[model samples]
Target chain A: MTTTTTEQTPVRGGSFEERRRRVEAAAYRIRHSALNMGEVQGQGYVGQALGAADMFAAVYADQLTYRPEDPHWEGRDRFLLSTGHYAIGHYAALAEAGIIPEAELETYGSDDSRLPMSGMSTYTPGMEISGGSLGHGLTIAVGMALGLRHRNSASRVINFLSDGELDEGSTWEAAMGAHHHQLGNLTALVDINALQADGRTDSVLRTEPVADKWAACGWHVQRVEGNDVGALLSAFDAVAAEAGLEGRPAVILCDTRIGRGVPLLETREKAHFMRIEEHEWQICREQLTNGYEGEGK
Target chain B: MTAAPTTPRLKTSAMIASFADPGQKTTPAPFGHALVKAARENENIVGLTADLGKYTDMHVFAQAFPERFFQMGMAEQLLFGAAAGMAETGLVPFASTYSVFAARRAYDFLCLDIAEPNLNVNIVGGLPGLTTGYGPSHQATEDMAIFRGMPNLTIVDPCDSVDIEQAVPQLAASDGPTYLRLLRGNVPTVLDEYDYSFELGKAKVLRGGADVVFVSSGLMTMRALDAAKELARHSVDVAVVHTPTIKPFDAATVLGEVDTDRLVITLENHTEVGGLFETVASAVVRAGLGKRIVPIALPDAFLDAGALPTLHERYGLSTARIVARTLAELG
Candidate 1:
């Protein structure tokens, strides 16, 4: 594994304001990368990629301890993408984190590209597991956590799951297992976009009182606006601090929009798998940039 | 509305009691004991079970290495998925469950999560090939067939306690995914008497003869050896070739022993399809030996729940049945 120098340093010792600014910048770049990758494919799970960009930024840019170049580093914290279709967001984050070259973003979802439409561990670097199948990442995370504990490794495991995956029984089984083993080093980040491939997540299978369900399963629960970089950073810090010491796993229920930054795409119906017109590509990018500039002002 | 009369459901406990009583005897510790020994030597070795710790003999590992043992409840998918995760973190995880669950319930997990990446996860499957009297649900008669097509997986069907003890350390030392058929709790001892040592993909000739040869695996090898002795009384000599490693099958050894004049029989506790029978027959056909090859294996159907002796006799897996089949084939 080649070791690449990280462009951004850890947020430790920085002021809360400074850390929030850095995280917001990282999230901004991640969203930009997602838009660029989406333009390459024209139609994909671009909505999911855009919505979860902030969460991915929080994990890769702020919380995760990893070498951008050396993804197979034994001591690095693992981030598993359970919802494999969210690879667009993860690829964006990877590019921003220097794990993958930002220039390679154009090759996403293309033939002979390392960045496939779905996240496959065999195809891409920094991908911990191949996960298109829902409800498998959390269980794998539980196992990784147990193994790390047995080896006395301080590495943490963070699994990214979607709201639609909550319907799988294996997810709950892993939830019970995480608590049963007292794996404090494990954390689950749920992207509750309220949409799935079938239809609305709730309509497909209601998973309301989500925070309560996790809490009942003995997890340290935190519900926050996933698009808010500051809230995501705080939630991660709290969970990281309590992990291993609390003897309980952690979960953050992130309520996020399907398409977050671009105003034109945010309210689009059936945005689960967005297909923008060829001419609308430049317009989407303009909306994203304009929105980011307005937020900054 | 009139209430319909419902048929009484058969009680599982009553069904269990009707099976022949497994007589109490001194049974040696099987895979779990060997695993404990290996775990003591290697800190990275861990044990996991899907609510079958006691039944699968993983309780022994749990007691020995309390901190390293993981009980994943009854979820077979989680059991295998977690084992793959453990393997990712540089741990040699021996994940055990009933063969039926591992092959049928959690096969996708094993295929994608474990076997796809070729992780160092040892999946120990208990109740292989009619070891249990609980009917088709527990009997893994077709497990070998289910896992045969999977790539990067080494399948092992140990003959007895001695073979299992030897295979455990080898499995730990091996770096890829493996599926081991397990015989738990007071497992029968057979290979030790023949001074047998397990080599990963090699077949050992337990006994050599000229008239007929039995290519066998699992406890069926022990039955073949017993049948060979019975054949000796009828002035017929039989050779026994034990092929414990099923996937990377030792075809050379099997073909080396084959002759056009002698009858070659492939016997296994599993179904004939995609098991030892298919493996040996395919190799023989490829070699164009033109030898008469006979397959004496279990039927590719759900077996009836009964005593071990009765099930063995019905399926032609018993020593007596094997001897009779060999004689009938010879005549």
Candidate 2:
């Protein structure tokens, strides 16, 4: 696959066409990085990583503003990964953000590398919270948002969660607390690929009417095709504008596909986790290069 | 059918006023007072309780920082999990619940979310061991054994109000996670003889003796001190070593005092099987210090409900039992 420097895009909130192109390019970068991460690990949650590539790309590339050199900057927006096993996605995103060397992606899950299968906050730069136990990010994000608002800072907090991670009751408690405090500066992007390890999330524990759940809890809700770079960019911009308006929090439901770009893996029922062999790896690389139209969700 | 005893008279001295001003008519005021002071100094500090603010004396923090305090409402697991979240966001969260719940109900979350991740969460657990007379249900008799096995968790068994007040900021400023056993509601005002400086993972020698070392922690340390004073009447030389930090056990301090000639008796208000007795015994054995060790702790049985003083005596956690144990072990 080639690394293309697409023309800089801005949305009409700045430049729509330019923003879409840059977002597509970012998706391509995250997908390639995730592939490299999975290859080094021999097996991983590559399917979910690939699925959430667009949302991750949209955030690191366009939404969040920060200096790669200063990850601990007080003013930088905080990004928390609640589904820790999906750290391969974050590894890809961090590489794109230049917090970690893009080449370090190949050392993922290696004996001596900093990248582990599960995310560790101290081990990884750009990880504001070390998340492994599910259902913890929203509460932490609430605290950071509260602190930031207290200090009169304009920085926002974005928490990335999996549909499956919502099974943790503590997550809902945090969601309730977030709305109760009217933390408008906090936005939670649920990468609703509808799959979790061991089986489909719905079959195991259905979290359907998910948007209504957030709305009923007092969050200003939005839904979008997560893989559509344009939609994701619009969703983020809309949420940012709505934040702190009458003190209502925001929840963007990103309806996404598992194993998004890879045709065979995208339809696989067990794509919650992937154990791709070397031959499968070649097929994935070829399919990504082909640049087929976005597949089924 | 008997009526519960009316409120006991407030029988404490002037030095204890710093600890008993929280309307509880007790010396446990310093625990909440210290937390309130720490919160005032550190704006990022927050307090949480599982319907235990009044019992743990964390109400002082609630009163001082009403917006920052979270009332978790009887859920111990949620209390720790939320505090872990608060800590992740760079907020110093001091969570208070009963020791039984913090050690038992929330053990997995405490070990995984807070300790394993090494978050700077301070868990202040009240009604530890035999401090209350509410029977086995309220007694946190085995908390030490339960928490000692968790990795990266610091365990503190404060002896009195002074130790608690001094240890609050010390634990909060230090990095990583800690579980502090609380002696709330009229905690004995002992340990005044010493300067009350508490170092993490360090044990202090309150009084030295040549015949026996009464190794203990928490409220039992006060009881042992009282026993030591009484033993002096019989000319029985008994030393007292107070180990506040249960985890990261001070092996050097423990071994420094252990000898074949002198007996080592561990006194605690906790269970004999898994609390201070087992901890000190394992440390002594692992360090190859084969002193005659006698454990002076509650017997392996569930205690029935009664008055606090009656229960302490029944469980053999009273000062008389400590003195008797030390004398018997010396023989």
Candidate 3:
């Protein structure tokens, strides 16, 4: 609800236990909202929503600075969602941040709804770039970072990407570009969930040693368990500690499962996208609620 | 296909600078010089290129404003993506690449990132149509045709150094995204002779004729004017109309020129199916002009790798070929 000063994130003032607990609770709500939206569509990228929930929460709830009422505020930190299909989770995160109303979650994927099936800036408030096509986010972030530095703005850019985008040559090009520009204001958070369309990520394409690849591209790299709120928060903290306007850009590669918390969906073979039966929606929510222990609302 | 008896047999490298004819008035890097002047006027303007600063004439702006110039390696997608990103942060980015790369390779990036958002990113594309002799890979023969489908993009096909210089200030001042088919590096100054003034989306009638009218754009406009002059010596009066802005075409001016029962011809450097030919013919058909339209355009095929002047003549876009096509259609 308050703005984070340039020196410290909103979570920095809180104790580690307190900060992690708040982020975990937000992640739980984010995952819960994602499941509800998925039921509306009958099938969607719900696996991605559940998988990348903690990372989104760490961004909106703890790391990023934005005014919900003023989503277009020039001073606010930017969160670019590059993989546009992750709107199920992104809508939840936006709702969680109060950038959009939580009640709007029910309108997800419906005609005339602000929340569409994919991320589009034309429809939603607080959605910076219209994304769906892969490998486009990081390059835009590089430009935004440079623009901000040119204007001498203290705002940071946090671009969200998926591991599937690593296969896109444009992503590597942007990685090289950001380092060439030495944009410390840019921070890329990659959701490394190993499931993509046509099968597991490895089978589709071998993108292992992603950290090394990013490092070779001249980025400050850190690979962590994406589902852990604490690890994710620490990565942001470490990045924040050394970031300057003229320095190497940072990338935190978070390895995550397709379906993170819900036991019923986690083991599902069709995990790239999920099609939970009407009755199974309740069970998935129950699994999420039961798995959550961050002082439930 | 056999080479025409009239077509020149010059060696490849000798005619690469075919656009800059000997002793003709010209300006070097009009696009670059104009952009530098624009950047000087507006502090928010920035220049970007995909390792094509030299080719696209963006290097002039780069040299003028090195801090604002960004060379995005040999990556077209990154160039556009970064331009859109910079636009979002309130900077006007003039991004350049070969038209083949911008129109075909990075169409999606242009569509979603710049056009969909309606950002202020100017796309200056070099080697449009048959300007290059580097075969299909470099020549952007279908640049305008491909960009015609994209909404909110203003497509400009400049005729000469004067056109590029004038269009630069206007393109930079306009709010939304635009695609400029750049005439770079020692471009001709033919339009200055007609007392021409470049308007954003308006067409100009260079000269009046009673026998035939040539509605053209790009370098084809230059050929039409030359052909019109040649046709006068043959006792035939030919009208020349230059429509540089191809997307929001000056259909009214073009259709006005086609009102007479004289033979109608559409001249362009692009294929006959799309570009200015199709635009003029489609408008004529829709307006019930009932005129039989003749086309003087490049064949809808992969063109050969050779000297520029020879390729132009072989494809019926050279001045002599235009005069020949006009007389045949008239007969």
- Write down the TM-score for model 3: 0.96
Q: Which segments of candidate 3 are over 4 A away from where they belong? A: A1-12, A243-246, A294-297, B1-9, B14-16
* 10 residues in a row with least lDDT, candidate 3 chain B: B11-20
Q: Score every model by TM-score.
A: 0.93, 0.88, 0.96
Candidate 1 TM-score, true structure as reference: 0.93
lDDT of 2 by residue, B107-207 (tens): 86787678877999999988788766666777788888788888888899998888888889988998999999987666667777765577888998888
> What TM-score is obtained by chain A of candidate 3?
0.94
Which is the winner by DockQ between candidate 1 and candidate 3? 3
Clashes of each: 0, 6, 0
Q: Is candidate 2 or candidate 3 better by DockQ?
A: 3
On the 0 to 100 scale, the lDDT of residue B321 in model 3 is 82
CAPRI-wise, candidate 2 is acceptable
lDDT tens digits, residue span A1-297, model 1: 112234323333377777777777887888888888888888788888889988998887677888776789887888999999999999988888788899998999999999999899999999999999888999899999998888778888999999999999989999999999998989999999999888998789899989999999999999999999889989988886775589899999999998888888897886578888889888888998888888873
i-RMS for every candidate? 0.6, 3.0, 0.6
Q: Tens digits of per-residue lDDT for model 2 on A1-297?
A: 011123211222248767777777778889988887788777988998989999998888877766677777666777888788878989998888878889888888888778888887768888776777787777667666766665567778888998887787767777777787678888999999887776888898998889889888889899999999889988877876776676878988999998988887886666666778877887887788676335321
